[model samples]
Target chain A: MLDNSMKLEFPSKSQNESFARVVVASFAAQLDPTIEELADVKTAVSEAVTNSIIHGYENSLGIVYIECEIKNNKLEIIIEDKGKGIENVNEAMEPLYTSKPELERSGMGFTVMETFMDHLEVYSEEGRGTKIKMVKEFKSVSIKE
Target chain B: MQLHFNVKDENLIVRFTGELDHHTAQEIRNKIDNKYKNDMLKNIILDLKGINFMDSSGIGLIMGRYKTTRANDGSLVLINVNSRMEKILTMSGILKIVKVYRNEDEALHNI
Candidate 1:
């Protein structure tokens, strides 16, 4: 069995961001990261959640399932949504390329995900869904006495 | 997120602590722009070390400041970057225009 792993589900929205954060934090606890690292994880989670809401659901209603795993001292997060999947994952990952600029998205969600995490992989198809998987290794871990 | 301003050597440094989502970007842009008019600003540095989360709205803020700083014949620098934020900056290629430093001291000295 994996020493650190978790999964959660939530409706896509700003308020549900906390739910995603909590899940990531729980899985990241073993890494014993500094407060800054913890914040980084949460911010990455926020971006993934935002994408699930904005792009996956396309401003409609949908469920987001998040799964996190800690292996070899690295944290991996997966955000999945069954909505209008991205037709071109590459275009969506580009910076400032949101389909809904009127919503003021800045279209940087995937960029942030790619930035904060050590590794990122996106899977999606039009009219299907999108799954964002991210990994981050804690550069520093605290030791408890 | 709210902002904290630190002024030294006539350079204005803004530290953002909180989420820079779409809802807050416009107000932040206005506030920072207003500060420029309020004083004879020389250089500006943004200390994003405390920023936990940001979206495209955050990008807009940085781009706006880049423009504002250039118009005044000054420069803008961003410091205390984490990986996630670094990725965003890299993707946006803001590094091509704005300078990013590891710390405020470094940014201040170089600016």
Candidate 2:
């Protein structure tokens, strides 16, 4: 029963992204994922965390929470922000999509998450908050040579 | 990320250091695109010697630069890949399009 889950809290912002990724990667070690799988997880984490920092907080200060759990051979990550939630999650999930293109964001956050993970779910409401749930399957782990 | 820049026969040798996740991707893209706009760059040698991490965003960044260089009739070469990122690049089908060199000098000399 290695169904361990971690709760993470960070100040909502982009600068702390690297820090958050490292933290999440360390917690996700139980899956014994391949380097590629790890990177995929990290990227999905980045997309969600970036969304929390950029879209959720809108550059304002807030609290971001990430929860991870391993269940049924799948790694589940939940990134939530207590800030202005997305109005249209469907529109936000488009590839190469970005509400703020000037930021050099590919706007492919959800697309990236979907591409890397086995599945992704977004729950949001305007002016309330947003929660993103992602599940990635660990089939065969391959260590780096 | 760390960048090592050198000039060889007017080609730009930019070696990346550290992770190439979403955080550093824009900087890399902008810097290289700026070079494409300003410099008389004939070729590019991306030395991935120190890059321990990369993702699909990095993949997009690479492909975008590949198209830019190909349009300019210049070439883009990747060198000194680590084990993991190399596997990703291989599976992503980048190896078929972009030439991989064993080291920086080979990439520079090959182009």
Candidate 3:
């Protein structure tokens, strides 16, 4: 359906992790992505939202904002949280480097997003908040040779 | 998520259904851990055939369970992991430490 955009704001509860992923996946379906592509988007969205709930907000009640846009065959998602921002974006993105290891976090959130999506960018301030911008290109909707 | 547990000897075989994510991981972990302690199970056999979706949180759950099993001198193995889930597990490098089986029998034999 051409290009479209949507925004969602929800409480930073663990339960909304699934909700965020499903909403993004449903919107991404307009791109006619394959099962695997859909799964990739869903996984990436889940990772971002989970990070907002557990790390950004520190598991306390907060707000998680998600913006999704489908442009041609490309889908861009921005997940932001007005919570405790990340101190080090690079270190946080490193695989297996979880600040909350006691919570059993695998620390693969950013890694998963980088692997599944075409582009990923992180913007954060020490005490402001964290924002994740990710873009994924769908091969299924690309022009054929 | 729903967990079906079967205890045989010192092994706890759990078949997980539904999505495994941050929302459901705690409940699933608690239930399995409780059963493992109450039944004194030494090993954990995770059957993931019924899992429709999973993310990195699934990896954390597995790794946590693996740690728990190891602490008790036991083991953890996975079975019926679809290619989709296998990709995530492989990306996380968990496959290097955990073993995967074709079915419950194979996991049972190996564990």
- Per-model TM-score, in order, reads 0.66, 0.76, 0.97
Per-residue lDDT over A1-145 for candidate 2, one digit per residue giving the tens place of the 0 to 100 score: 3568889898986667888878888877777877778888887887788788878898689999989898756888999998899878888887655787655555567877887889999999889899999998887744333
lDDT of 2 by residue, B1-111 (tens): 877677777788887878886668878888877875677787888888788777655666777778778998998888888776775566556678999889876776678
Worst ten in a row by lDDT for model 1 chain A: A100-109
**At residue B33, what lDDT does model 2 achieve?**
77
Model 3: share of real contacts kept: 0.81
Error of 1 at A88 (Å): 0.9
DockQ, per-model, please? 0.27, 0.22, 0.88
Q: How close is candidate 3 to the true structure, as a TM-score?
A: 0.97
Q: Please state how well chain A of candidate 3 matches the true chain A, as a TM-score.
A: 0.96
Candidate 3 has an lDDT of 0.92
**Model 1 CAPRI rating:** acceptable
Model 1, span A30-131: residue lDDT tens: 787876677668777877787777778866988999888777667878889999999888998887788876554567777777776789999998888998
Give the DockQ (C-alpha) for candidate 2.
0.22
User: Which candidate leads in DockQ?
Assistant: 3
Model 3 CA deviation exceeding 4 Å by range: A142-145
DockQ of 1: 0.27
- DockQ measured for candidate 3: 0.88
